[model samples]
Target chain A: MSDYILHCFAQSGNAYKAALMLELSGADWKPEWVDFFNGATRQEGFREGVNEMGEIPVLVHGDLRLSQSGVILDYLVETLGTFGWETEAERREILRWILFDNHKLTGYTATLRFLRFIAKTGETDVVKWLETRATAAYAILNKHLDGREFVVGNKPTIADLSLCGYLYWPDEIGIDLSPYTNITRWLETLKALPGWQHPYDLMPGHPLPCA
Target chain B: MSDYILHCFAQSGNAYKAALMLELSGADWKPEWVDFFNGATRQEGFREGVNEMGEIPVLVHGDLRLSQSGVILDYLVETLGTFGWETEAERREILRWILFDNHKLTGYTATLRFLRFIAKTGETDVVKWLETRATAAYAILNKHLDGREFVVGNKPTIADLSLCGYLYWPDEIGIDLSPYTNITRWLETLKALPGWQHPYDLMPGHPLPCA
Candidate 1:
């Protein structure tokens, strides 16, 4: 058993956020696959034992069991001592973007992707609405990244990790990344980071059994 | 001049989160109204100077300027020394719920309210879809509030403030809160807090001119 066990699935970009950070930092971690598609997270046992929120990417490190990718990523920064902020100001800045990402970016993109790619909801009005919101978030991020290398400060921090969670799946998300030049360029920068692995390659449960 | 200035309007629940905290903590803060209904946030000038994300509830204090309700709430806790965590563990727990609020609860409920009440888009497919998502989030929060007085711990924290931002206006949100008995009970508990005010009463631009 590894020092850290992450409950995750390949299709979950949220889970990939933590998985990528642990792998990039070279933490002694293993992936504990959660059958999310089969209503595993919704089960009473999982909610009671794992995350009460009925979400995925629960990280178990010894006595500490953490959920919510933002919290897990912050914890990894402290324990792994990499991809983190140096000053209090930088930490808050990183946190600001993380909150924005969770609230706006991943919040919309993940839902859009689930409907279009996973659930196969087709081109419904709801999907269209989600795409519009997701695109707006992408525009804000693209503009913010105009002259920056990463989401926060001069290096790759958890902010970049959190925002880029669902962005890597543009095809599945049904969004055109080509138009957002700055975002595409920034994605390239993060992709070049050593030990960076795509969500599908890094976690289990890719290519859903039904698909 | 007030020690703190918050850029907000009456109808914004996100802005209300910060306003409620400032009032509850007895912080010397003033609200600088933004004409959100008139496209103030979407304007280039507002985006450039106020918030790059084109959102409301930007808190300006001394030399520091903060946006994102979560960031502002966290900053206020540090400055006001109230409604915050006593330990690192408790802080992380608070953060977990806040993220859940921003990503799921407020994420869905805010938009749903905007469409159903503010925008008055009628009962379209999008509205129906949003209601489904919003109700799901409410169920999770209602269940979590069971046997607990507040969101994180026994006392009210930013987590409670953040989640309660949009819950006060059931009529505006177009979702009957009576079904979520736990959430309604929790809201009453928070309402009983000294200095607590409804979002409409706490901020400016209430009762839109056209409405």
Candidate 2:
């Protein structure tokens, strides 16, 4: 048994946030491979037995079962002592970006990707609507990254990890990354981190069984 | 001068989260209304100067200017020392819910309300799409509130503040939340708390100039 077990599927960038964190920290963690596409998360048993939130990337460390990538990343920072804030101010700053990532970045980008690639919804009204919002979020982040190497502080923290989770999947998201020069640089910088792996390589169920 | 100044407008439930928190904590805070309805946040100057993320609910306490309601709530927990966790586990638990609130609950609900009530898109395809996603998010939250007085612990915390931000505007969201019995009960319980006030009342710019 690994020290930490992450219930995750490959396509989920949210789960990749945790999976990548565990890997980078060199923690003894393993991916449990959730069958999200098969409607596993939608089932009652998964809801009752696993995360009541009905989501993946549930990290189980001993008796503690935790969901939410932000929580898991923060927990890993403390337990593993890697990619964390040194002071309360930095911690708050890091959290600000993480909240922004969840609310704005991944919030729209992930949905656009899901609709366009995974769900194959095509260029529907919702997909186009999501694209505009996602692009706006990207523009804000690109401007924020103008002179900074990471989201917060000089070192790479979980903020960088969380924000970069879905950016690496731009192909699936069907977005033009050329316009966002700073964000492109930041994503490349994150990719240069030691032990970093693509979401598909880090978890299971990629290319889908149907694919 | 107030101890804390919240850069907010009444219609923004995101800003209201911090406003309500400041109120409940009995912190000396005043709202410096942002003309969000009139393209204030979208302005480049506001984005570059106030918050690069380009959103309101910015909290200013002397030297510090903080954005993101979760960050503000956590900062208040430190400064005010109320509605905060005593243990690491409790703190993580609170953060879990807050993240869920930002990513799921308030994310969809707030957008739905913005499109329906404020934007008044007239039940467009995107509106229907957001409605579906918003309802799913609500269902998950409604179930989580079962048999619980608050989001974390028995007492109210920032998690409740963040989740309840948009839930109070059910009419604007065009969702019949009555079916979510636990959530309805939880809101009632929260309303019974001392210093509880509606977002429209707690912040300025309630009745928009156009409205």
Q: Tell me, by TM-score, which candidate is best.
A: 1
Error of 2 at B116 (Å): 0.8
In candidate 1, stretches whose alpha carbon ends up further than 4 angstroms from where it belongs are none
DockQ score, prediction 1:
0.91
Error of 2 at B52 (Å): 0.4
DockQ of each: 0.91, 0.91
* Candidates' C-alpha lDDT: 0.93, 0.91
Q: Residue B143 error for model 2, in Å?
A: 1.1
* Cα lDDT of model 2 by residue, B17-125, tens digit: 9999999989999999898888898898998789988888899999999999999999999999988987899999999989888888888888888888988889999
| Candidate 1 per-residue C-alpha lDDT over B80-163 given as tens digits, one digit per residue, 9 for 90 to 100 | 999999999999999999999999889889988998888899999998988898898898899898999998878999999999
